[model samples]
Each structure stands twice: as structure tokens, then as C-alpha cells.
Target: MSATRPTLKLTHSGALQALDGALRKAEELGVPQNITVVDEGGNLLAYVRMDGAKLLSRETSMSKAITASSHRQPTSRLDPRNEIKLAIAGGGRLTNLEGGLPIIIDGHCVGAIGVGSGTGEQDVEVARAGLAAIGAEDQKP
Candidate 1:
């Protein structure tokens, strides 16, 4: 077996594009948001805290992005029963919130986007917009 394998990575420009899309969506919804983007390894790529967004949500948004990237799935899909455990295990870096979405491209998860400072549904909607902007697959229903 080969020791090295090819992997898709999220570019800084792509991360910025996703952030812009999420910001536009938040503006359209009249909800300022704290948005974050992270690479597949859960390393931060981009972030934005829109004017009027909840200051405390900045950390939550990053947590959501990191959780999505690490889990390779939407944060909303995580087992609620294990929410506390997951958070503890991640040292508060993981969350079971609805704002996080994995950025899937060509069947691979490249990264993730997360939005906070809005209702769960609204946050997901914004994140979906980000995925759309980057031509990534949105979370399945």
C-alpha cells in the first residue's frame, strides 16, 4: 500500500468566497452572524463577525466549523445524546449546533462552514449558502 495519498484541500480564496456567501445570506435574512470556515483538519481559514452579531457567538461559530470538519458531517446531525460528552471530549471545541456544514467536493470533505448569532434553522440556511457558493454539496435531508 502507498504511504501517501492524494487529498483535496480548501483554498484561502474558496474560504473567502464561502464567507462572503454566508454573509450575504445573513444580510438577506436580516440576521447578523458570526461565520467561520475551517480546513479538513479543523484549522481555521476564514472568519467574519457581522455587525450587530452576538459577540459571544464568535467562539461558538468556530466550534461549529471545527466540529463539522473533524466529524465530516453537519453539526446538526450529531447525536444530541452525546452533545455534552462530545463537547467535553473536544475541550469545548465541538458542538451539536445546526450552523455547521461540511464542505463536500467530489465526494470528499474539503472543509466546513459555520454560522452563529441566529436561530438554528437560520444558521443552517446561511451555511448552506456558503456551501453553494463554493459548489460544495449541502447536507442531505
Candidate 2:
């Protein structure tokens, strides 16, 4: 094996694009939201707390993004049996909420988007909009 391999990454611009898309969807749904974007390594790239969004949900949005990036999948798909355990193990960084979605492109997870301050289904819908803005693959039902 080679000592190095090429890797796909989500650029800052892309992260902002995702954020914008999520924002638009939230507006259309008439639900304010706290949105976050994180790289594949779970590093925050972009974030926004929409006006009137729940202030407490800002933290949850970041947690969701980090969880999705770390797990390389939608946060909603995480094992529910391990929800509490995972949270404790992750020191609250990981969550099983339905607002986190991985940004997958060319079979690689580039990053993730997380949204909060709405119903779980609405949050997921916003996250999906973000993924779509960047041409990332949506999670299967």
C-alpha cells in the first residue's frame, strides 16, 4: 500500500453552500433552525442560528453534525439501544437525533450537515436540502 492516499474534502465554500440551502428550506417550512456543517473529521466548518431559533438547539446542531461525520451516516440511523451509552461515551458529542446527515459524494463521506429547532422530520428535511445543494447523496429510507 502507498504511504499516502487521496482523500475528498468539503471546502469552506461548499460548507456555506450547504448552510444556505438548509436555511432556505427552514424558511420555506416556516421553522427557524440552528444549522451546522462539519468536515469528515468532525471539525466545524460553518454554522448559523436562525433568528427565533431555540438558543439551546445550537449545541445540539453541532453535536448532530459531529455525530454524523464521526459515524459516516445519518444520525437518525444510529442504534437507538446505544443512544444513552453513545452520548455518555462521547461526552455528549454524539447524538441519535434525526437532524444530522452525512455529505456523501463519489462513495466518500466528505462532511455532514446538522439542523435543529424543528421537528425531527423537518430537521431531516432541512439537512437533506443541504446535502442536495452540494450534490451529496441522500440517506436511503
Give each model's whole-structure lDDT. 0.93, 0.93
lDDT (Cα, tens digit) per residue for candidate 2, span 90-113: 998999988999999999999899
User: Which regions of candidate 1 deviate over 4 angstroms?
Assistant: none
**Clash number for model 1?**
0
Q: Candidate 2, which segments miss by more than 4 Å at Cα? A: none
Tell me the TM-score of each prediction against the true structure: 0.97, 0.97
lDDT by residue (10-121, candidate 1, tens digit) is 9999999999999999999999999999999999999999999999999999999999999999888888899999899999899988899999999999999989999999
After superposition of all CA atoms, the RMSD between model 2 and the true structure is: 0.8
RMSD of each: 0.8, 0.8
Candidate 1 worst ten-residue window by lDDT: 132-141
